[model samples]
Target: MSDHPMALIYGGTPHRFPMLLVDSVEELSEGLGRALKQVSANEVLLERFGDAPPTLPSCLLVDALGQVAILLLRERDGGAASVWYLGGIEAMTFHTAIPAGSVLRMEARVLKRWRTTARIEVKAWIGAVPVADGFMVLSQRGSGSNE
Candidate 1:
C-alpha cells in the first residue's frame, strides 16, 4: 500500500462533476457508508426516459450506487489510474421514478474482497420507499478491456 493511509474524502473532485449522485458522505466505516445524492432537473432529462415521462434511469441509479462503492473501495485501497466497470449487475429493482429535483439517499456495503475483485451491495431510496437496489463488481482499469 506504499505511503497510503486509511482515509476517505466525501464526494471530491471528479466525483462531483457530471454523474455525481451521492452528495454528502454522511458516514463511512469499514468500507460501508450512507451517502446522499441530490438530483437536479438537469439530471432528470426527458430524453433519458425515451417515450416515458421525465424520470431517472434505473441504470443511472445503479451508477450512482456503484460510484459510492468505488469511492469507498479506493479510500480503503488507493486511487488507481485504471477504471472499473460493472462486471455484473443483478437483482436490481426500481420502485419509483426518482423525481428530477430531489435528494436521494444511498447506501453501499462491501460484501467481499479478493486479490483483484470486490463485491459490494448497493441500495437507494427516496425517503422510506426503495428506489433501487443492486450489487456491483469492480476491477482494476488497465488490466481489463476498459482501457
Candidate 2:
C-alpha cells in the first residue's frame, strides 16, 4: 500500500489490517527498531471502550511495541518469510492512558537471542510523555513450541 521502505517489509509479513498496529517505521537496524502508530478516533478497538473518551487500550499499546519487535526480527532475518510469535511479557508498566488522536512513538531493541527465542525490550511514548515499557519474549514458529 504505502511506498515507505517499511511497507515492503510489512508486505512480506503475514500481518494485516485491524490487527497490524505499526503504522510506519522511522528506523530499523540489526537489533533495534523505531516505529509509529497513529491512534484515530474511529479505531475499531475504541468501540470496546463505550463512551470512555475513545482512549487506546493498554493491551494494544503493548501489541504495537511487539509489532516493532517483530519488524526488527523480520529485518534481522533479511526479510525472510518467517513467523514469529509472542511468547511472554515481563515487567510491563503502563504509565498512562493513551487517548485517541495521539501518535505513539515506539521503540524495540533485542536484548538477547538464542537458538529460536529472543528477548526484547520495548517502550512507547506520546510526544515527550512515556506511555508504556516492557520486555517481550518472542519465539519463532516451528523452531520450538512456546507453550
Candidate 3:
C-alpha cells in the first residue's frame, strides 16, 4: 500500500451516507484505477426503508467512480489537498442492481486531462455482469467550496 492515507471515501459528513460506499482501492495508476465495494445486506441503502428494493442505488455507482478519480489524484501526487468536484456526468446507464453480499468491481480509465480538468470513463460490475457505466468530468478545485 502507498503512504497515502486510504480514507476510503472523502465525501461523507454528519448526515451523508450512501455516497461514501467505496470499500477499497484494488489497483491504481497515474490516471487510471480499479476500485471495489464489498456489499453487505446491512448497508444503509438496503436498510433505508425496511425493503424499498433489494438493490444498490445508481447514486452509489457515482460515488465509486468519484473514488476512482480521487485515487488517481492520490496516486499522481501524494494526495489531493483540495477538493475534486464532479463537474458533469454523462452517458450513465444502469443495467442491474448490485444486491447485498456481492463484490462490486469498478474500473475507471482516464479519457482526457488538461491541467485542471479531467474526463474519465467508469464501469462497474459484479462477477460477470455489468451493473453501471458512465462518463464523469472532474475539475480540480483551487480555493472554493464544493457548493
Best by lDDT: 2
* TM-score, predicted candidate 3 vs. hidden true structure: 0.79
RMSD of 2: 3.3
Shift in Å, residue 8, candidate 1:
6.1
Q: Residue pairs in steric clash, candidate 3?
A: none
Candidate 3 lDDT, tens digit per residue, 1-147? 334434434421111355566667777776778878888877777535475646677776677677777667545645535556789999999988778789999998888887777888999999989898989998876433422
**Candidate 2: residue pairs that collide:** none
TM-scores, one per candidate: 0.74, 0.88, 0.79
Worst lDDT run of 10 residues, candidate 1, spans 4-13
TM-score of 1: 0.74
Error of 2 at 121 (Å): 0.1
Q: Write candidate 1's Cα lDDT for 36-147 as tens digits.
A: 8777776633245446655777677877888777777765654554445568876777778887776889988988887667788998888888888877877655433334
State each model's C-alpha RMSD to the native.
5.3, 3.3, 4.2
TM-score of candidate 2 against the unseen true structure: 0.88
**How many clashing residue pairs, candidate 3?**
0
